[model samples]
Structure formats: C-alpha cells, structure tokens
Target: MRLHFHPLSPYSRKAMVAVRLRGDAVELQEVDPFSRGLRTAEFVALSPYGKMPVLETSEGPICESTSIIEYLEEQGPAVMLPPGRQRLARHWDRLADLYLMAPMAELFWRRDTPLGLKAPAVCRKTWGLLAQQLADRDFVCGDAFSLGDLSAAIASDYLVRLGLEPPAPVAAWLQRCLAVPAMAWTVELAEGHVQRFLKPLSAEFLADS
Candidate 1:
C-alpha cells in the first residue's frame, strides 16, 4: 500500500495513526498538492480533488481519510476499532468529520484567506466547543481507542498549536492517549510536520511543558 499525504494535514494523520496502530507496514509518501508548484500533474491525476491523504491499495486508490481507515480495518488485524457497534461508530466518525475536522480546517485555511483577520476568534471558538464536547470522555467513542481517538488527537494538536489547552477532562484524555506508545509515536510524527509548517505554533504548544 502507498499513502500520499501532506504532513501537516490532520486527515492524513488520521490514516497514519490507524495504519501504525494496526501494526501495518506501508509506504508513506509526502505530497503537497495544494502548494503552488509542489506536486506533479501525474500526482494530481491520482487525486483529482487535489487533496492529501490518498491511499493506493491492492484494489484501487481510495480517497478520503475515513474510507482509507475503513479499508484498513476490514483487512488489517489488531482491531483498532470495535465491531458490532457499526452504526454508533459510523456516527462518531461522522461527528469527527463535521465537528472536529471541519473547525480545524477553517482555522488552518483562514490563515491565508480573506477571513485571516478573524482567524483568532474562530480558533478560540473552536477550542471552546472542543473543550465542551470532550468534557468527560476518554476517547470520542469510549475508553478504548478507536479511529475516533486518532482523529480527535490529531485535530486537538491544532488547539495546542493555537495556545489553547483543552479543559480538565479533555486534557486528561489527551494525556492518557499520549501515554500509549502507538499514540505517542503518531504524535511525534505529527508534531514534526506541524513544526515544519508553523515554527512558532510548535513552540507555543510546548509553552506549558
């Protein structure tokens, strides 16, 4: 399997975390289809939407992080997510897409958009909502780590980058997730990508450290 991902993208991070936690060894390729002159036309053909986190599998190319994760879960072992609660798990994953990832994407994209002036307010609001939704949950779905955990953790890194730490429950949840060896490894890889994108953001994340 080949994964084409942008290092700074939480969506890509989601797929990476799922693959790594499942103990699968796949080739990782960094691509910047968004950068003005970064990617080739051939690569763009693979991702007509010009987005990162495209996974090439034995069957075909799967776009979208959630789809990639589902494919991995269907084929791989270690069962990062639980079975029998398919409906609930799907809803949680949708929540991650709508609530978690959408807000972060807004903040990240606006930094270079016309709404850049309102980025700070948007970021603060995003963090506040996240703190509320994550009030007392160890993971998005439950105590056992799932794809929801990976999505939330990667998205939360943006909160820390913006100099906003989640409230008690969320903070404790994050701490516990990081204490897991697989999660820690994923976080380290993610932090490096974040640092490369925004140097001060990385420093700000470690301010309270």
Candidate 2:
C-alpha cells in the first residue's frame, strides 16, 4: 500500500498514527496537493477529490483520515478504535468534528491573513470551545486511546505548539497519549517528519502567500 499525504496535515497525521498503532505496513509518500504536484491525471483517476492522505490499499483507494483509519483497523493486527457504546464513537466523532476540523480550518485559512485581519473574537471562541470540550475527558472518547484521541492530539498539538495549552484534565490526557508506546513511536517519527518536511513547506507557502 502507498499512502499519499502531507506530513504536517493533522488529517494525514491521524492516518499515520492509526497505521503505526495498528502495525499496518504501508509506504508513506509525501504529496503536495496545493502545489498540484499530486493529482496528476493518473492520480485523479484513483481519487477524484484529490485530497491528501489517500491510501492506495490492496482493496482500493481510501480517502479521508477517518476512512483510512477504519481501513487500517479492519485490515491490520491491532485495532485502534474500541468496540462499545456506539454513542461514544459518535461522541468522539463529534469532538473531532468540533475541535479539530473546524478550528484548524480557520487557522489554515487565516495563515495568509494577518492577525489584525483575522477575527480575534472568533479565535477566542474557537479556543474556548476546545478547552471546554477537553474539561472532563482523559481521551476524547474515554480512558483508553481511540481514533478520537489520536486525531484530537494531532490537531491540539498545533494549538499547544502555538502556546494554547489544554485545561488540566486535557493536559494530563495529552501526556498519557503521548506516553503510549504506539503513540510515542508515531510522535518520534512525526517529529522528524514535521521538522524536516512540514515546517519548511508551511513556511515557504506562508512566505509566498
């Protein structure tokens, strides 16, 4: 399997973490979607959306982080998502939907815009939502690490890096997740992937924009 992704993208990070945790064997290929370097005519034939973190699995191409994670868990030796409380899965999904995807979308767009141009009130609101969501939980879903925890961690890692720390419970949770052998392995790999690949690419894009 060949996984196409951008190292810095939280979505791509989720898929990578899932694959690593599940012990799935696949090749990671860095793809620049915005640069139009990927999604050549051939690539588009595989995934019409032309999104990053596309998994070219033995069965077929799986796009989107959640889908790729499900695929890995289904095919691999270990499972990242636990099976119980279907409502909890929904809860985890909602947390990711609310905290990770929404706020990060704002950050991504605001990358080119100056802080002055960006809405301070909106930024505060978003961060507040994140902190509030994190107030009670060890993981996004529960005690054990799940896909929710992995995705939220990667997304929240961005804010933490930017100096917005999670509330007490969430901070402890983040530390717990980080300390896991599976997550630690991914983070070790991710640190180099981000330093050597992602940060430079993001800096170049922001500079040019």
Candidate 3:
C-alpha cells in the first residue's frame, strides 16, 4: 500500500496520522498539488476529484481523508475508532472537519473576502464547543487519543500560524493532542510545508490585518 499526500494539507495530515497510529507499513508518496500534480491523468485515475491524500491499496484507491482512515481501520488494528467510543470519535471528527477545518481553509484562501473575514469567528465558536467537550476528558472522545483529535489539532496548528490561536481550554487540549508522538510527527511535517507556503504571503496577510 502507498499513500499519496501533500504535507501542507490538513486532510492529508489526518490520513497520515491514522496510518502511523495504526502502525501501518504503507509507503508514502509526496505529491505537489500546487504544481498541478493532481491534475495529471495518472493521478486523476486514482482520485477522480483530484484530491490529496489518496491511499492506494491492494483492492483499489481510497479518496477523501475520512474515507482513507476508515479503510485503514478495516485493514489493521482499530486504534483510531476504538471499541465503545466509535460514535463519539466519529461525531467530533465530523465537527472538526466541518466547523474547524472548513472555516480555516476559507480563512487561508479568502481572507480578504467577507466569508473569509467571518471564518475566525466561526472557528472561535467551534473552539468553545470543543473546549466544553474537553472539560471532563483529555481527548475528544475520552482519555485516549482517537480520530477526533487528528483533524482538530491540525486545523488549530494552522489557525495559530494565521495568528488566530484557540482560547485557553481548547489551546491546552491542542497541546495535549500534539504531545502524542504520531500527532507531533505529522504536525512537524506540516509546519515545514506551511512556512514555505505562507512565506510569500506574509506581507499580504499582515497588510490585510
């Protein structure tokens, strides 16, 4: 098995974290989507939507970060969607992808636009909900790290880069999540890509602020 991904993509980082947590032996293929790598015919055949983090397996290719993680769960030990906590894990994963990551993407790409300008407020409201969820537990679902932590942590990392750090409770939770070795590795890889991608835009983003 081989995973094709871009380090800068939170969705890609999510799938990568899942693989590492599960101790999967999949090979990594780094693709530069910004360089039109996803548009090539060879790559499109693997993922019709031309998305990053496509997992190629013996059976076929799996697209979408969540779908890739789900496929990997079936193929090996279920470290991510643990027993008795699958529902909670999936719930927070959905919320993180929708409320945290989606808005972060909007803010990154369309910061000067009206919707982009509103993204930070949306993220703050989501952070409140996440903080409430973490009040009694270390992880989103419980004490153990799960799929729910992956997406939210990655999004929060980028939010910090955008100068929109999460509030105290959520920020502490983010720190706890990143303390996991796999999460730390993924975030470190993402940090390099993010710095390179944001370097040229730093002045523009500062001026907009």
Model 3 TM-score is: 0.92
Q: How close is candidate 2 to the true structure, as a TM-score?
A: 0.73
Tens-place lDDT per residue, model 1, 30-137, is 875456423567666666676778888889789888888888888856366677655556665766576656666655554445454344455456546556656666
- TM for every model, in the order presented, reads 0.77, 0.73, 0.92
lDDT of 2 by residue, 73-115 (tens): 6665446667764356556655665655556555544544554
Off by over 4 Å in 3: 199-209
Model 1 global lDDT (CA atoms, 0 to 1): 0.67
Alpha carbon lDDT of residue 157, candidate 2?
A: 61
Order of models, best lDDT first: 3, 1, 2
Clash count in backbone of candidate 2: 0
Q: In order, what lDDT does every prediction score?
A: 0.67, 0.64, 0.85
The model with the greater TM-score, 1 or 3, is 3
Clashes of each: 0, 0, 0
Better of 1 and 3 by lDDT: 3
Tens digits of per-residue lDDT, candidate 3, 13-118, equal 9999888889999899999887899999999999999998899999999999998998988876889998898888899899889988998898777776876767
Which model scores highest in lDDT? Answer: 3
Worst 10 residues of 1 by lDDT: 199-208
Model 1: colliding residue pairs: none
